[model samples]
Target: MTDLLWPGDARAGDLFTDASVVEAMVRVESAWLAAGGHPSELSTAFSVRDVAVAAEGGGNPVIPFLELLRSRNPEVAEHLHTGLTSQDVLDTALVLQLRDTAAFVARNLDRQVAALARLAERHRGTRMAARTLTQHAIPTTFGLKAANWLHGVLDARDALSAAADLPIQIGGAAGSLAAPTALAGSPAAALERVAATAGILGLPARPPWHTARAPFTRIGDAFVTCTDAWGKIANDVLLSSRPEVGELSEAPAEGRGGSSAMPNKHNPVLAVLIRRAALAAPPLGATMHAAAAGAIDERPDGSWHVEWATLRTLARRTAVAADQTAELLEGLRVDIERMAATLTAARPGIDAERRKMGDDGPYLGASDELIDAALARAQGKPC
Candidate 1:
């Protein structure tokens, strides 16, 4: 029966095709073929065997024919999978994809952090008015603000890298590897072999987590953290680019924005896109968590299935957003003169306070000390 309600096709360029995912599939397929498993069982377990093995075979082959295909072109389904369930391949594939996605995001985040660090250093002492609760509060440096953003991005990058190390599921039927145990040694040995295979593929080596889904949930949480940082940066850019503020501007580049009415407008469309991407993260995370939480015993009926789609979607969206965010940050523009003017306009009240203080030193109380402390911390120096 053809399923008309199936989601659109996933292209080869999708983030799901990350190297980790490819390596994982290769590992599973290798294990299956090494265990002398029949292609029929494998086809039953992985419904997309044709799609997975089409490069080595012609059309859709029957179970018995698949074995012949496997033998004739052993390389066709080389290391094909055996003794594992669908969840093993699917879950492991997810972890692999996440690992690659995390790496991609980390690279971009590092670039943004370094760029912001330079911007912060350049504007370190350039004073600007600080706002709190939507009202002007005190004087602060534009560089300090950029430094704060860099710190947040750096923290998120570390978190994402840590979360990528979560284990993948590899247990067989009933999450006990009973079938593989009957064929090979004990279930423990079977699981160890699976873990070793996963390690060979660069995935984290750990016991099957068919029922325990903290790993998957953690990946989603990490993505949320990254998106939140990106969204905050975007929000700042949008606010600073406003006509009234005019303290910052998007770089004058092609493909920035479009308008039907306004001829002299350079909207912060990239900032808006960043916000949209951040907004999309929570629902994806919620769906993943709900799927994990609904797991019943060793195998939650459709929980893992639900998780697969969301995980893939999350990876693709995150990669796109990360790439776009890096580009946006790299080309961001700041007007130091405008910033100074804005600050000077707001300094009359602060000057009044300073005048009231008589000769009690500088008006910036502890701010310089705090900045020094922060800078020291960032540079790995003790306060």
Candidate 2:
């Protein structure tokens, strides 16, 4: 899973990767063994590449992975994958991977929200021109704009939190706990095993969700929501950083925003990349929803298979976008002088119109109050 096109893959840390997915799947298998009162430590003899190559025979990595594990760890051969199907192993592993990814995304979004809060507080009265339909409409403050962005990101954070609080998938063959219950001697014991396994992985325990695709859909939608908020900020930055507008600009780094052919260009590359992710998110979300809708049987033929890579890609893009947004906000260079100048240039006509409508000054009604309210809301913890 090396891709030059995806900004997420180019970053330093491996948030989501082929190797990480294998590691998560291994964790799920280990947890299952531990819950069954067996030694949980499994062998690490197989490489990710080996499992992937072997997965061609089966539809997923779990089958081949278990084969390799069973061959290497003969002690746990009977217990490994005793009550779980491929869906159980893969879905639970995905949840674990999403759990870690959610934490990382939440941290970056927190950084973005904190930075926006600072901007809102600092520039509470820094007036600027408000645009409507891409035209100068009225007077507004930079604080209000930043506050607006903050509100959107906060909403996205909450959505991601709700989606991240997902339960572990432990349904046996055909979405039933039959095998586990028969093995445990009772359904209650089987559920206890599930709860115990979930506890080990720091996830909630729930009944079989093999057919219910809402959790995966929700994760996809959350990723879209996050990127939507980030895209709003990037769009604003892109428009305002135009040479003609000169209202905002990314703080310069040594190798950032340079052009290959043009010598005098300092393009807004960060926003461009964030916007790119934003544009791609909605389609991925739609794909998840489509998969959910087309999920027909206890285990879908192709729809369930469709989810693994789509969700992984969505997570990667969303996580990378969060990091980009945090960096964008951290080094955001707000040109208060340019904003004031733009406001001064555009306010007179609107002021005259307002005066004729019995207003004495620019009607910046509730701008300050709304910013305060947004900042107050931002005080709440990130999900």
Candidate 3:
């Protein structure tokens, strides 16, 4: 399913792949072993595809995965899991994938922000008609609009970056790792040692967080916010690029946005896809919140399972939008002459003082300060 909707960075795509799921299984098992727990040849019985097929029946990949692992090598079966439950493995794997995804998000966002900043700076005085409710209301600059877009992107980027420090989930079925430590050793000490091994794999196992669910929720919100930023940019791009408006356009490229029915037509394909992603995002985010509400009693019935696809889709879609936005900005074509033509007669009631701020003046209240703050945010620096 992701293969069709997915057309973005390779690394980002890899995070959600079947191979990645298997790789995570290996990491989790190895981490358990590294902590002085003895495990077996894991793949003795069922193959990778067999585990996946088994997951269809159990609603979780871990149950079948463990069964296959132990069945293949019974002698080492007892030493394998070391008291972890299916939820523990699944949840921790999610955190691991998200952790890797954060780096990809950071890279793409940085590129996008930088491109927008440069575009905004160049068009600081480029004027256009500011619209309210889809009607021309006042004069504004293309630079200010770009800056506004930059500000939103910056906010989303910060949210995602902060959310990136996701805590790994490592609780057993009932939300405790006690089953493994109930025998002799100190639970805290053993858990800490195992967590250290997890840390080595780049997934920081910072305490247990299976019930919290904040990490997933926060990331979902960030994904929604990020896509929304692109949506605004895409919406404006669509409007401004229209033949009637002609203020901006998707930079002309060979075989890009070509209409199948009309050879003469060139569509704003990137913006279209970005807007589509934004439209899809809010609903997905809502689902995550709804799922959070249902995460009751120690484990959720279907709520937790709901997020398995929702969060992945949300994050993946946002990543694709980010990459497309960066590419769009790189080749974006601005028609300064056309933009200025729209300002022959400004709206009657705009304040004279506000209008004096230059072409970008009236619509950009404190935009200079805002853009600076946005730049600081993009760089992950103190403002």
* Top TM-score model: 2
Q: What would the per-residue lDDT of candidate 1 be over residues 298-332, giving only the tens digit for each residue?
A: 88877766787688777666766677678788888
Q: How close is candidate 2 to the true structure, as a TM-score?
A: 0.97
Each model's lDDT: 0.69, 0.88, 0.76
For 130-195, candidate 2 gives per-residue lDDT tens digits of 898998877889999999999999999999988989789999998889999999999999999999
Ranking 1 against 3 by lDDT, winner: 3
What TM-score, computed on C-alpha atoms, does each candidate reach?
A: 0.81, 0.97, 0.88
For candidate 3, list the clashing residue pairs, or say none: 44-72, 45-72
The top-ranked prediction according to lDDT is: 2
Q: What are the per-model numbers of colliding residue pairs?
A: 7, 0, 2
- Pairs with backbone N, CA or C atoms under 3 Å apart (clashes), candidate 1: 29-79, 29-80, 29-81, 30-79, 30-80, 32-81, 32-82
**Candidate 2 C-alpha error for residue 310, in Å:** 0.4
Ranking 2 against 3 by TM-score, winner = 2
Model 3 residue 232 lDDT? 91
Report residue 35 deviation for candidate 2 (angstroms): 0.8
